[model samples]
Target: MMMKAVLVDDEPLALGFLKRQLEKVSSIQVLETFTYFDSSSNISVIKETDIVFMDIEMPERNGFQLAEQLLELNPGLEIIFVTAFNQYAVQAFEVHALDYILKPVQTERLKKTVKRAEERINAKQEAISEKPTKLCINVSGELMFHLTNKDPEIVTWRTLRARELFLYLLHNRDRSINKDVLTELLWAEVDQEKAYAQLYTTIYHIRKTLSNYRDYLTLKSVQGGYKLILSNTIIDLYVWEKKLKNLSTLEGQTIPIAEELMAIYKGGYLQEYGYVWAEAERVRLEQQWVEAAQQLAAYYHDQGNFSSAERWYRELCNKHPDDEISNYQLFKLYALTGKNKLAEKQYQIFKKALEDIGTGVPHTMEKWYMNWKQGIARKTSM
Candidate 1:
């Protein structure tokens, strides 16, 4: 079945251009085109479509605002944004949009995005077939395994490492773990020959255990060593990471992604493993989180939503207490809101935190904090 699509752009040229470009791909069926998002119009015209190619700068309401309304009528709709600006990446992903195509969409990129959509749709359809067969496999006497969320035969409580082969491969996501690295990470103390033989046996058991659902997941040998080939369907972490990306972008528009991001961020990422790549990714995402909060705070502040700005600032303060600039901003904001005591308290915290970090306050900020605190204290005392 062909995937239905629609183009929503207020600009005539942009709409016409995307329609023509998308028409090149016969598989993508553009059902309708909307110049603006008007509820009075039968929104179902676009809502019924499987995918939406929407523009952010449409008249009346932007893409996100429009998407909120559209999804009320169509929950599972996939939106691919066609935008002239890239700065809105955060907002795009915040909504869980399928993908973002910059203006003047390239044929190759559009095709790739379409292919990805096809893969997802196919996986979803397969999931609806018959509730997915739930089965289990016991690897040797130590390992228990699962399919479709069903726990395997438990001779004993187990972890992925119950089968050393799966443990090493599972730890390596989308990357082939080298035999030497596996030897080092898995069994540095054991004899090399013994380790290799054990590894081969482990691999065989893994394949045997997972053979039933091989289409959904597999362990395959590569030039380097081997790869655990699992579809995006089974890995909740992939979905979790992608949800973060959607919330992080300006186009991956899905509502409730915010709640999902917060819920999924219950703990440090991949808390079970401390692989170098995993740790690096964790730090990168954490940095991105702070940067995003800062951007959103500044955006809200400029939009005259001071309360929201202050909320984000406070969160940032808690996360990055040593940031002198963030502290200064909060102190000033507190003073503006007539919370002199709170401002004074925050300034002291800032002073102490700065001192603790061994970075002295800047002269300009020091003068302001001193002056503000003294003035407030004098006003209270007087």
Candidate 2:
């Protein structure tokens, strides 16, 4: 497997040496090099990088801090710290670095590190290949389905109409769709006879495409409409909504289950499809997500658990940056947790985001911040 590698060192000489050594490893591809860590330049590329050859000692931030940031962007990223000092050996291992090699780098030692990285990459690929195949209908992002076995191939449709028809049926799987209505909606400009013929052709291709999973699923024409006979299909939207419905019955204790349900929602329903029919369900699912996140954040904050509250709010903000409420709550939680710098940063970002949308900070938010500021001042005076 070709591994994407990044080299980072303040010393240009060390970087050059390491880059040359890495070039000898046929498996490693040096995608980029950085002498310093900056969020804008580093985080974007580092998120997609597999391995990083980092220098333990550096100006501004040490290798450990850079590793921490990289791991935050991608937890699966393997870091190998290269430093001349032995004092940082224990600290290097503490961060779960892939390997630590002493500078004045020996070829044998570097090769050992590369071997370990290969083993890790191979193991991950094997684990993925071992997962049981399922017909996964992903409505949270692009409307697509794929078998999750072997190469994990995506099921492609013959046409856009065929894909949309499949998505519409899946979205409304609880009931069968009327054949006539579907034809009119999908092919409104075409003649009724031509539209019906086209619809049937699309259905034929869809069935042919999903022929492998025929034992577990089938398309059936019943009464005046078609229904998907999915005895063993995994629809993400259905599963997510079902889990959310169960959360209400948990009687006030809904933390663990709520979190699990919320995490299943990768994005809005059929978000990339941009179909008008999907908007209602998409909006409904998104609202459910927002409500669940708000309740969880509020529950933790009210219990005086600022750390957990901050985490949930920050997650919400990351997913929905335009969510002013989540941003505001996160800002307050940061202050309560004695993260004044983070609180100020969150406030500034929130202010700028609102301004970009042609609005100023909400008066209520301003009032809350003023009150908090006054409280902080009183405490500092004492």
Candidate 3:
């Protein structure tokens, strides 16, 4: 396969020479050359191009920064940094540049870089084609499929109906969903006959998308309905909830386990998708996480682990900024630890959060703060 490349060098001589050298390699096709990095002009070409040969020292920006931006646009785009200095070699690899070739690029060295780029591109393509043995469905944030020993693959649905239908089936997997219910839920705007036809077409697309994971996920028709069966597959939310249920009382031995559970919660269930059907589950799972986090923080506070307590409470406050109990706990913890400024900051945050929702700080909390302030004033006078 021919690999398309772009050359970016501030020096006209260097840019022309690199392009000429690349021309020597039959596999490398020079698509575009740039004297400077211009986002507007370069972005469109960079998207289609396979490789970029960039100089480390440029007028607008260093090659490392430019490469980072390019990678963000096309993550699969290979970057080969060409420069006169040997010092930038280490920095080149730091940004994951494919190869670092010195200036006055040799034909042999250039060929080696081209070969390496081709190998990497081919490997990525092969990985995409390979089927996964086991599957892990992540619904905590966005919908993602984490295949065993492979990067998470985001499913690209053929159409909106196909996406919603597949998510609905996955959400209620193992139970046969009647065609009538699905039709009413998704295709209510269409006529009955047209709706059914659309459903069938959507299901076909879903099946084709899941063809690689057929061994793990089986979507079958069951007597006027459809069912999605999971074998050797797990959903992150289910696994997290199960572990939370099985967890015993929090202690020195169980603290690590609690921390591990906290790490697993990437975000609310299907948070990014914003599916109305998933709202209840999302709120429920979030509450579960909040409760677990509160229990862990309280345990640390009770055991006189003030530092750990502060850390967990801060985490809770970050995730649920309006959580009054967590904010109060953090305020008290900071006060006890002699971080009066942080304690006051926490109180102000709590106050603003409550006020935003048309509420005030609880009377008892206000009274406690007033009393604490008076005591501080008395001590300061002495």
Candidate 4:
């Protein structure tokens, strides 16, 4: 495997030297070089590379901080610290650095590092290959299924009615859906005999498609109805709700689980399908996300960790921009954290957002802003 690599060093000479040395390794393909860590540049580079050779002393960001952010952007990214200081070797390894090399890197040492990188990359691939293939159904935004093996299976319907029928049964999985209800929902415009025939043909195609996936799925005909059953399958909605339930009952230091829960919510439930039956569940899951985000934000803010609180609040706004209460809370956090510019910017955006929705700003918000300004003035005066 040809590993795509990036070099990040503030010193031009050091960056050049590393680039030249890396070129000696036939397995490594240099994708990009950066003198400083700019979020925009680094993130773009990260999307195309597997390894980042980072320097310890950059102007604004040190190697450790850059490494953390890089991993957050691409968790599988391998980081190798190339620096002059041997003192940082312990710290670099602690952060899961693949290898640490000091200034004036030896060609042999560099060769060994390249070999280790190849080994680590191969091991990761082998581990992924050994894992069981998961069946993931996204009933949140798109009606789709993905095998953990990475190839997505697109269900082609013999007729549009066939697709809708399968979705109906999936929506009411485990419960037998009555034939009359199915007919009314999917075939109301057709004649009785013809409608029944259509349903039968649709069910046949569904069964045929599912036949090969018997280990993962099943469709059964019950007395006067049909039922869809899933085995070893993961539905995002079910997982999100389960995580929400678990996280809601717990208090304090729930960041780890909160992060997991946030990842599970792909988007509004079955949004692409736009079936009337999905709206209620969609609304319910959205509320769960809101509560989870709010709780995490409050937890971080209460802990005097403004940075983490800001991150969660920003995510909340992305999901629910109309949440004025959250916007106000975020504004307060920004002001308290001494981000006066961001606080003011948030207020303007919030005000305009409310006006666009025809609600205008509330009296409570006006009063709160006045009090906040007064407090700021008092601090400034003192």
Predicted structure with the largest lDDT when compared to the true one: 3
The local lDDT score (0 to 100) that residue 262 gets in candidate 3 is 83
Per-residue lDDT of model 3, residues 1-382, tens digit only: 9988888999999999998898899998888888987866668898999999999998758999999889878878899999999999898999999999998999999999899999999998897688746789998888889988899999888997787888899999999999999999898999999999988988999999989888689898989999998988999988999999999988899999989988989999989878899899999999999999889989989999999889989999988778888988898898899998898888888898888999999998999888878878898899
Greater-lDDT candidate between 2 and 4: 4
Alpha-carbon deviation at 226 in model 1, angstroms: 2.3
Best by TM-score: 3
Per-residue lDDT tens digits for candidate 2, residues 47-157, read 778899989889978999988878868867999999999899899999989898998889888888999999997887786687545777777786656566545355778
Q: What lDDT score belongs to each candidate, Candidate 1 first? A: 0.70, 0.83, 0.90, 0.84
Model 4 weakest 10-residue run by lDDT: 246-255
**TM-score, model 4 to reference:** 0.57
Q: Model 1 scores what on Cα lDDT?
A: 0.70
TM-score of each: 0.48, 0.55, 0.62, 0.57
Ranking by TM-score: 3, 4, 2, 1
lDDT by residue for model 1 over 1-382, one digit each (tens)?
6999988898889899889888898788888887975755766685568888899987668998877667657756787888989988889888878888898889999999998888877777787785666433322213334565565543331235435556456647468877777766666789999878766776777677666666556787878588876553334344455666666442225323543454444334454445454576556655656665676667667766789778878887886788766787888888887878788787777777888988877898889988987887798798
Report clash pairs, candidate 2: none
Q: What's the distance in Å from true for residue 2, model 4?
A: 52
List model 4 lDDT by residue over 274-348, tens digit each: 778778988988888788788888888888888988998988876766688798898888888889888888888
